[model samples]
Target: MNLKTVVVGAGGISNAWFPPLIQEGIEIAAVVDLNIETARAQIKKYELKAVASIDLEATLEQHRPDFVIDLTIPEAHREVTITALQAGYPVLGEKPMATNMDDAREMVRISTDTGKMYAVSQSRRWDKNHDILRRTIESGVIGKVTAINCDFYIGAHFGGFRDEMSSPLLLDMAIHHFDMARFFTGADPIAVYAKEYNPVGSWYKGDAAASCIFEMTDDIVFTYVGSWCSEGCHTSWNGNWRVIGEKGTLIYEYDKAPYGEVVESDTTDFHRPLKKADITDSPLEAFGMHGAICEMIDFLKTGKTPQTECKDNIKSLAMVFSAIESAKRRQRILVEL
Candidate 1:
């Protein structure tokens, strides 16, 4: 079926979403934004046969699309998604799920009550390398994973709301890494101890750096250290990963394919002999945003649940909020809900 959608929010992020929707041959019925001109401009830029509207309720009343693509800003996510879900349309939204846990929980509750699919576009999880890393770890080649460490350092100079918001790195960026941690470990957070700060000479006005230690399910330890203001020797946006298991370890760095080593033989020597373990790329229908869109499309066509469905995605969002709370109280916070 050629699904139709009403896209809510036509800001800069919408550009990243439009191409994938077009590629999939999904019809965009309309684009809704507070700035009608912005929505109109996006429609024209993409040469979409879609209407531009300023009001979501009015647009929803007029067009019964298959779903709503919510590209609104973080603060607007809860309102836009709840409105669409309540109006009886499934919604695919940009990440950071909501500004706070209360809103995130409420959105999840409404999605369940309405029986509508509300999925977050956690674009990073769809990457092929990420998929392979997840598969390799799960394949038991590295034995049972005990600890996971990630380091992200990039000198981002985005001169927008990010430059001014408090906990910009944790709230605006680290959610991707946090979600990926869950994807790889298949573990939900149990508790978190974190410290957030603004590094010297940082361009962003808020706390642009953070170090968090998360206690995950199965007694797994996941540590994340990141800086949005580091000037040199930057790591990949996916971050550098080192996943340690009982019998071996896997390392992924610089956006390259991951490789690992496992115990080859049991010996009386100080260290057991090790052998190289190759990580092959797992097949993906698409990558990044396009990949996420494919999952939503498949979910609509079939009854299969997408990985980032609100109920599951909320746990990742909880990690972000819990980290912030831990940073604030200078105490470990339990991950609830």
Candidate 2:
């Protein structure tokens, strides 16, 4: 199948999307950005068999691509996605789906009305370790999962739009962990209570750290603790995780191998017999962003549904927004997914 795609944003992330497209032998029909020069630079840098344009609609109208890659910022996602869906094109876009739930629902509505696929790239779900953990829990090696906790700490110093946003950690970064928590637990969000704070010596204008507790479907509790401005012993971008089940626990670190241990059932309530269980990683065909694009490509060709389809991704976005709402209201917010 010959696939021609229009990528709507020519920022740094577009660079990441290109290699996979090239490897998959997909054609870039055009690159579009508000700044034509930025798009031109991408075309030049990649030696793309493509053109650069400042207008997404114009390029889409001209090329009539098989699909659209909406790499634009969060605020632009709804418009870009709607325009493409209206144009009868499927979309593989970056995450946070849209700036807010209303816009997200609108995009999903358009896709539903148009019968087109709109997938959000929840890239973290493509990790080998995460995939392994998900499978292990599903296989009931540790028995039915009851709770999950993730700890993330990073001293990110990106001096751009991120440093200027309010609730920077929750808005910009926490969505990945939130989405991953849902994937790991295989549950949709039910409710959330959260608190945000800006630690002293933090460079960000808004809160750079947060603690969120989400009650998920099936009585699962997912807790996330993250900081974007803490120094020393930073966790992996994927964070450190502990998944507790009825019989045992699964532990995963971003850089190291994930493992599980089982405890023998005994009469003692506090103390139990320990057992070391063999745990194996379920490797990925591709890693990170590339893996996500691969799935999108497969969806376009074979009509397989991507895991982060907009209808489903709204649940993940709901988790992010509910956490923000909880932080602001100082109360548990029911997720409206």
Query: Which candidate ranks first by TM-score, i.e. highest?
Result: 1
Across 1-337, the per-residue lDDT of candidate 2 in tens digits comes to: 7889999998988878889888888899899999999999999999898999987888988999989999998878999999999989999999879878899999999999999999999888988888888888877888888899999999999887788888788877898999998888788899999998899999999899999999999888999999999998999998999999888998998657778788866656777886865575686888777887888888877889999999999999998889888999999999996
Cα deviation at 262, candidate 1, in Å, is 1.4
Alpha-carbon runs more than 4 Å astray in model 1: none
Per-residue lDDT tens digits for candidate 1, residues 203-267, read 88889999999999988999999999999899989899999998899999999889899999889
Worst 10 residues of 1 by lDDT: 277-286
Strongest candidate by lDDT: 1
Candidate 1 collision pairs: none
Q: lDDT of each model, Cα atoms only?
A: 0.93, 0.89
- What value of lDDT does candidate 1 attain over all alpha carbons? 0.93
Clash number for each model: 0, 0
- For model 2, name the residue pairs that clash: none
